[model samples]
Target: MDTPQRAGHVAVIGRPNVGKSTLTNALVGAKVSIVSPRPQTTRHRLLGIASFPQGQILLVDTPGLHRDQGKSTATAMHRWMNRAARGSLEGVDAAMLVVRAGQWDEADTFAYQALRQAKVPVVLVVNQVDRLKDKTALLPYLAQVSEGREFAAVHPVSALKRKGLEPLVNDVLALLPEQAPLYAEDEITDKSQRFLAGELVREQLMRQLGEELPYATTVEIERFVVDGALLRIGAVIWVERDGQKAIVIGKGGERLREIGAKARQQMEQLFGAKVFLETWVRVREGWSDDEAALRAFGYHD
Candidate 1:
């Protein structure tokens, strides 16, 4: 006799920069989401599907929940990010809250509120345990976080190191419904190659450029041409102002070139074909706040 098949949706939620995206990638066994050290790097609800012999896990990577200050001055982009992350929890079979060791603030607590309201099986994913200097220090923190709410299970993992992921995946799969696979066994991510290409370019910007500039920037793939085994891509890097555009292009165009090179390499690896990438910077002022512009940029729900 064999174990029954199980498949369902699992939304990965957490505060900003708490390793939610990293953990999702680890569990899915592929780079379904682009990562950056910056907060709110993920702009949408992206699905990373991991199919196993007995079960299939649909891991939804959402934007990190922004920390709420006493006063609500959260920008338009922040509002959108929060709405997206919170919205992903609805209708999901399960939810996982990724938090760092010994770091639980209002944001983590806030995440808990959303999960509790969703009335779904919630798993507490304590990520970045590798950062702990003393392993014994983990007990108190773990016990502390576990005090409130009934988590289906608690998993301590290091998303960056890819450690303790097997157990985590197994545990998450057990919570899924006993059903057939939702996606093909070989398919890892639901995002289109074109979207991933633009995301890769934005990732390069976040990794290579100044902190403030990356937030001001967004990548758009204006054209994608495929000819048999070769792919040609033309992308526009949008910034809010001329000074921001200048920062992205750098003094000698060296910065922009570096971004393009790395992003093109990522595109080639993902598409498994020769890729020709062209990137140019343009100013799109106040696009984040403009609903029409945001819709044009594919930020629609």
Candidate 2:
């Protein structure tokens, strides 16, 4: 007898840096979303298509759910991120609430409440289990979290090490309706290569920069030209101030060069083509706070 096929969207939601993007990439078997240690690295809602022999899962990777507190955190960018995170729940067949192993806070609770309000099936994915020092604490923590809340399934998996994901995927697939694949098997994500190129450069900025510098910076792909088998990409790194620009460029342009080199390597690996990436740092002056500027930087929904 032939098994039924199931396919639908699953919203991956969590607070900042809970490995939501990592889990999406792991399930899709590709880097569809850029990852960094910094919070709110994923500013857009992205679709990652994960295929199995019996079913397919369309994963919606969104920005971390966060509160805009005080003057510092209250910016147009922050509001947009919150909206992006909340907006992902719409029409999803299931919601996967990702949380760090051994830790649950107000933000996690808020996300769960939002999912409940949306009335979607919630699957609790406790990510980063490999980092837990005490393995004995896992069962107790799971029991404690499951006491008050209802979850269709709960699985402790390490998104980075790719452990314990088989059962998680199986259970998530069962939640969807029986249907054919929504996207082609070869297609891993809905984002274009041009959009991904900018994200890769921004990922480097987030990783290489220190403190709050990465938050004030963004990458714009000025030119993405396909010349034969090679990709020629030009990126403009926008900073909020002149001092930030100088710091990003570093001494004698070494830092900017390193950022470009690393980003180009990632782009090549993902696009499967040789890439010539050029980057320039420019001052934007409070672009993150200005809604008009945010839209110009591709932050619009």
- On lDDT, the candidate that comes out on top is 2
Model 1: lDDT equals 0.88
State, as a TM-score between 0 and 1, how close model 2 is to the true structure: 0.98
**Candidate 1: stretches off by over 4 Å:** 67-72
For model 2, what is the C-alpha lDDT against the true structure?
A: 0.94
TM-score against native, each model? 0.97, 0.98
Clashing pairs in 2: none
Error of 1 at 131 (Å): 1.2
lDDT of 1 by residue, 210-249 (tens): 7687888888899999978889999999999999988899
- Per-prediction count of colliding residue pairs? 0, 0
lDDT for each candidate structure:
0.88, 0.94
